[model samples]
Target: MSISFAFLLKHIRPFGTSGYDTFCSVDLANFLIGNLGLTLGDIRVLYTAWRGVALSDAQSAAIIDCAKDVANARWGQLQQTTGSTVMFLSGIQLQDLSNASLGQSFTWRPASKIAVAVRIDGGHGGHHARWDVEGFSGNTDSQGAICHFSDLV
Candidate 1:
């Protein structure tokens, strides 16, 4: 059986060169229960990111700490939902973007772009579902990036 899920990222900051870093967290409970019609207990939470510029040892630690805090906040929000289970998933992938101009503010350039792909599993629901979601990508400024969901098999 396949299940359809919908979620959105709340606050994600642009990459910068001043050794500045930002972290964001999103709540999945509302998306699961309100949109997908599933209880929090029946769902799982998985967080992933493509590693960007690594400034220094302290910067790395701060980034990790921020990510954890965001995750926990999202989990807590999910718990407020009745009969929900926040199952954290593993296997996070980090992409290095030290050479790319990530968080910098400058004119558009193709070389400094990044892409993120989100896979959503939609079980045999026997119908097409409507998805209205927002996300970020390398071409966000010009082309605009989106979170995609498709069914395989």
Candidate 2:
């Protein structure tokens, strides 16, 4: 059987931490399924290649990008088959609370939107976190953040 989106997201690691362009595992998974025409089994192989191996960030990005490029060459567009609603929230950077724990809670008002995949970047501060419409969690070097939300409607 084919794997589900949620399943892929949970399996992949953080894209930025994994040497991707500030993208998390979920985003890459979306790209693979949404942008690239990759099945879950196909993706699992990629993950297996680097699960325990140590490679530079550039090398990792190269591998993933190569796969992405191949998919693009084969498929014209990676359209969502499920017709899910995607909303990207830019300029919604917020600061973390003082004396907060790792994965602290913070809030950002959205334009009446929900999310399926969320990514937060504490730009310049090198602090990255995960967020939703309601709240978020993670440590920050500064009080700045960038958020992207994909609603799985």
Candidate 3:
């Protein structure tokens, strides 16, 4: 089975605290599943690594970039069959909130598009995610925030 970007966006909820890796790992795992031709088992392992640990700090770019670079060196960086994956900004930075409309404390999906909101300091933000799932307790949702077209990179 193939999990498309649309599917992930329509199903996965935002992690509390707007951590970049939370979103990045999920994306990188999906991206690698498509790019590297990983097995279903490999994909399962990849997803498990999501939100498993915190790799944040002042120098997280280097940290995340290194993980993205080095994980390709082998196929089992995480476990016997699971290779760790990392996410990097594709250099398509934009602060467009023209489509975002999520509220401050809900997991319900809105008809409008989703924006990942990044904090000016601490943690990570994309589009405008603060109000997306900040107070959401559910692990997943029947529907999720839509990934903005600008954020399709």
RMSD of each: 15.3, 14.4, 13.6
What's the alpha carbon RMSD for model 1? Answer: 15.3
Stretches of candidate 2 exceeding 4 Å from the true structure: 1-24, 55-153
RMSD, candidate 2, Å: 14.4
Q: For every model shown, what is its TM-score relative to the native structure?
A: 0.25, 0.24, 0.25
Flag clash pairs in model 2.
15-24, 103-138, 116-150
The C-alpha lDDT values of all candidates are 0.28, 0.32, 0.33
Summarize candidate 1's per-residue lDDT along 78-153 as a digit string, tens digits: 5422111111111121112212343322222233232211121223212221112222232122222212212211
Candidate number with the higher lDDT (1 or 2): 2
Q: lDDT of candidate 3 vs native?
A: 0.33
Clashing pairs in 3: 115-127, 115-128, 116-126, 116-127, 116-128, 117-125, 117-126, 117-128, 117-129, 118-125
Off by over 4 Å in 3: 1-17, 20-31, 50-55, 59-153
Number of clashes in every candidate structure? 11, 3, 10
Q: Give the TM-score of candidate 1.
A: 0.25
Return the candidate ranking by TM-score, descending: 3, 1, 2
> Least accurate stretch of 10 residues (summed lDDT) in model 1?
85-94
